[model samples]
Target: MQKNILFLVTGMTPQIITETLYALAVDSENSDKWVPTEIHVLTTAKGKIQIRSRLFNDGIFEQFLKDFHLLNMRFDDSTVHVISHQGKELEDLKTLDDNELAANETCRLIKLFTEDDNSKLHVSIAGGRKTMGFYAGYALSLYGRAQDSMSHVLVSEEFEFASNFYYPTPYEHYVGKYNSQERLNAQHAKVFLANIPFVRLRHALPDTHPLKMDGYQFSDVVEQINQSNQNLSLEIDFTHKYIRVNRGEQVNIPPRELAMLMWFADNKVKGKSGIKAPTGKAKGENSVAENQIIEELTADYLKHYDDLKGSETSIVVNKEFFDSTKSKLKKHLEKKLGVELAARILPKQNGRSMPFYLPIESEYITIKDNFKDRLVSIQ
Candidate 1:
């Protein structure tokens, strides 16, 4: 028989799993209805401990199964995945880097699970931090199959977050309400599963094994999918001072920075070595290559000055302005599009004589044209 897998995102609340299972149980009178054959919880080290202590060890999960007489469900510590960074399991998401790692890890596991031909994954986003829930849902969107689904459990307001309210009891049972700490019967509580509609993107990915897909960052995967759909090409509007990345988002840059970016992009088109910015007094204002760069940058900056900032915007072409603009543009690309993608569209630097140049082929870069903005042939 094919497998039914439940992939749950949780923090200190393993109860969500029981509650979700309960919702599945009550939704059908059939004994084996939506009971998963296997369960996997994505959480942190501290969360795993809490789940083991409050749910598995205390017999809460087993008690729920026994109450419902569920014979097919299975879960254990081996099923609980504690997301780790650099080999050490993370206690909790504490910083921006940790969150990025979590997103990547979640995507990785979701990709792995869906890679199996016989597994239908059901993802639960009812517990953990808002970011965690978002990552879980987004990962499913990227790689989820036709049989896979996403949902959240909605508990009645009184029982919501109540310590004693894991699920509606098969028999009369009392649990304390969060606000007044008043006892309420678990059997009377209302629980429902709200199915979330998500766009399936598995078709956009190349047909490859999950293990072979391991090295890709989450953002790169998204970019590749988007590029495939859009047949990615760059559009720069000097008048607006913004460059459109693919067909999705537009990033606004200062005229000076835009000019610097354009110069490097043009060099790629011309098959010229990227000009290296000089340092200290000796490196200032001499070489034929550097002089040509200064001239071109000044012209590009001035060309956009009236349209971008109007006549009030002054154009400066000194070594200081040139250097600062280049640095700022790199930082902006890295910060906005992420390091993986920035490396593609931004100029690459090396210790060789040609210190920097656009790595993208000349064919993909285009200046302003009258093209209808519809799907034009990527030539």
Candidate 2:
């Protein structure tokens, strides 16, 4: 029951719209092919006029629908959006500034249509300037979801640029090739829709991402996604007490909290289990495994205290502090990184009796000891 929307980017040639629509809905025998309920065009003012004159005003658009026995095709002037520069509709994209404006406008429209939850967009980049088509496709790559698609239309050379050819008619229709005296039957001209593969980066962005915010530039969005794709690593600056999560901004943590997190991260990198004791252990006995973890954490905590709190100052390490600090560190990490990412650092408590541990694999973790050689280093 999803509404299908055809979003086309075109220049002087608006035939690509009808040709793409025909290939998607009518020409294909596949029952699953998408049939758009509405169509929208992104073009300059001159391009809009061309589309209006040849397709709408001249009755060519309606005639195509009628020929294919289609009903309720929604298209009008309101749907034909003219790219504007500085809030004025552009006559045509002629200069470098005009092309830049076209790119911005194309990106804006693609983002708007993709944000709608009710509509599944089919974006055609087969028409328009080379830069225009690139921006349209790239914009879709940025915001497009699983339901959205990007494509280009390919018409046989004989009729590709022919003035008389739009789409194949149900009945035999003759059309002349562009700049050639010979005429050919439109029915014999083959048309194909090529699906373009793009890396969908929308999944990497949170629902509250800045890209979803209005007035955000396209380049900024691409940069953010590229940063997110870099290998996941934790650069724990013990001196600074902050962790850089996934090449993003640094997350600051207090020295005490950093000690506890580094405890788990260090154990993970060293392939040591976070569980101090086996499941169902006695209440008071210090299991061999539990004691080892406490010893490791004590050494790590003492290093931070000695470096930042003076080597003469002494801090007690026991079950009370360990138990309380562990809980606080988990809660703080979760609050800073959100639920999904925190789970990577400190996995959820699985069972009532089972101890929690760092679930992030060792391969993805790096523990650097660059605090002036005061701390143990594990990479």
Candidate 3:
């Protein structure tokens, strides 16, 4: 069964909720109606009070449903979500920290809704503070799938922000003060739902991305998405026995696996073609060229291994050891970095039973023998 969800963000004016609901389900202009199975609103603590008092306590929401004869929509106090930070619901978005909390909460709710494969989310950014609306729309763009949609409710000029107005009623319902006023009828008000077009980046995120997990803030998700677009780079430190990706974090693998990676990186930097794998044979068992290649690679691997261990020991780099080390290194990189990034740096074989070489461009790979600090003299 398809679950149609109506999600919104609001501030002082809770009327946007009723107005949006009217446009979606009651208005005759909306021929293709989307009557939500459930409605959820994200707001501050103060906004929640206004919604409760004006929409529920005053029976405005109930009256609207009765007037339109709509049914089966689940919305109540539980669905009205208040933004919180550090274990307290925010009273308002008055400070920068409060705004950040609202943004993170918006992202969390959107992520939660989009996770349900059976749910089709409809996000309304027609209410709330400007920043709050922005966060809501941006969060939808980040997590929204093909089934999800976004919109802004457009009310007629006279009815918009009118204190006494909520939604247009079916019968003659007069609202507005009677000072200089011949009262306006609520039935004549026009509400247009403006569908918003957004660039979908949900598919761009990896399946195992942290955004898929809970507790990630809005800024963290944005930073990760931004980092994914950066050019691939590797900083290898022999002394530390780790690789720093994009100058960010250190990734450590087993000493033998690390040595094998170093060998491949070195060969790539030295402008070598894919090198053939060793046959693990004695001098006469393999061809002369194969024997020389095996010795060269084994010696290179041992040199790196000795440096990493801080001493040399009896260790043989046979064909089986070579293949296993390569496999382990690939898995480690894939686990640390994502699959796409790991594929770019991992050694690649051109064809079946072919020589393998590092695929990453040489310019991006930097190998340092030792860490050094530079001191600048002031004139």
**Tens digits of per-residue lDDT for model 3, 54-168:** 9999999999889988889888999999998777888889998888888988999999999989999999999999999999999998899998999999889877756678998
User: Model 1: which ten-residue window has the lowest total lDDT?
Assistant: 369-378
Which regions of candidate 1 deviate over 4 angstroms? 28-32, 208-212, 223-379
Each model's lDDT comes to: 0.74, 0.75, 0.82
- Using lDDT as the measure, the top candidate is 3
Clash counts per candidate, in order, are 0, 0, 0
What TM-score do all the candidates reach, one by one? 0.60, 0.63, 0.78
Q: Which of candidates 1 and 3 reaches a greater lDDT?
A: 3
Predict model 3's lDDT versus the native.
0.82
* Model 2 segments more than 4 A misplaced: 28-31, 225-379
lDDT (Cα, tens digit) per residue for candidate 1, span 1-379: 7888998989988888888877766554334457689999999999999889988889898888888778877799999998898889999999998888888888888988998989999999998888999999999997898999889988888888687678888789998877675789988888878889999867753344222355777766666545544444676654456777675588887665776676666566667776565432234457777666666656655544434445644555647775677778877865555444555677667764456677666787765523233213222
TM-score for model 1? 0.60
Query: Measured by C-alpha RMSD in angstroms, how accurate is candidate 1?
Result: 16.0
Best by TM-score: 3
Please give the TM-score that candidate 3 achieves against the real structure: 0.78
Provide C-alpha RMSD values for all models, in order: 16.0, 7.1, 5.5
lDDT of 3 at 333: 76
Instruction: Summing lDDT over every window of 10 consecutive residues in candidate 3, give the lowest-scoring window.
Output: 370-379
